[model samples]
Target: MATPRQDSSPKGFRPAFYRMKDVIRITSLSRPTLYRRIAAGRFPAPVKLGGRASGWSAQALQAWIDNPSGYAAEPTADDPAS
Candidate 1:
């Protein structure tokens, strides 16, 4: 993967969206792992931005990184926490 480009915009002018490659770079996750998490509903879903294009929310991704336990495996009602 190519190195992500540094934001060149002024402090207030940066674009709100990031490409899939950017997302992959930021999360340090392989394509399959990222998609698998999405399929399992453990990660944020990408929004369709344009023709054959999609992107995830930067805020949401950051939040997930900040609190990873929310994505950990959980027991069903029949199972006791241990």
Candidate 2:
């Protein structure tokens, strides 16, 4: 049997998937404002988890948290110019 791979990151650390309510609590942004920023490419877009469910990536949220003013959504392959 092979030993399990170990994560060298902080204990209890894992990629978080934050729901709308959690995101509101974390960023203190209203739903409308959050949507506006996402539309403007000024914030990370939430990923679809399943039917009628979506959430933001912790890494993406961290980028915004680190520099809210300078944060810009990274272009994805879906983007025309990307």
Candidate 3:
């Protein structure tokens, strides 16, 4: 008899991080617009993944998706309060 495979992640779980391309695709915002929004504190900043690599948190992106116009970036230790 074959054993059943077990799934570790929760149901409907997605990747915890999204690359810039993924973010742009999900938000339907151009690269420039995304950067501008991030600079203006209207979008979530991506977390550093490693050398020269960064990705946005799925939770953060989902929050923005739920309320785009009202979305505000939360300050992180790497970012200075403005």
Candidate 4:
């Protein structure tokens, strides 16, 4: 019989997924504003989790929080390097 695979993650290293409420709480932005910014590409987009659920990447959110001025400075795969 084949054994099941184990995650075996180290303590305190698990990634955290923040819901809309959590994002609003941490960023202090209203729901309408948050969604508006997302629509305008001013904020990081959330990943679709299911038909009715979505969440932003915590790492990406953290980066924005860390540096709001140059948050979009880093070129993305679609953006050409300059």
Instruction: State each model's CA lDDT, in order.
Output: 0.72, 0.92, 0.91, 0.77
User: Candidate 3: which stretches are off by over 4 Å?
Assistant: 1-11
lDDT of 4 by residue, 1-82 (tens): 9999986998777356688988998899999988887765577877788899888878878987997656663445764554
lDDT of 3 by residue, 22-79 (tens): 9988989999999999998899988899999999999999999999999988876766
TM match of model 2 to true structure = 0.78
Pairs in steric clash, model 1: none
Model 1: per-residue Cα lDDT over 1-82, one tens digit each: 9999997768865346667798788888888988888766576667789899888767667666787558643333544554
Give the CA lDDT, 0 to 100, for residue 53 in model 4.
89
Q: For residues 63-82, write the lDDT of model 2, one tens digit per residue.
A: 99999999999888898978
The reply for model 4, stretches above 4 Å from the true place, is 1-15, 73-82
**Poorly placed runs, candidate 2 (over 4 Å):** 1-15
Q: What number of backbone clashes does candidate 3 have, counting pairs of residues 3 or more apart or in separate chains?
A: 0
State which candidate has the highest lDDT.
Answer: 2
Residue 26 of candidate 1: its Cα lDDT? 82
**Residue 63 CA displacement from its true place in model 3, Å:** 0.9
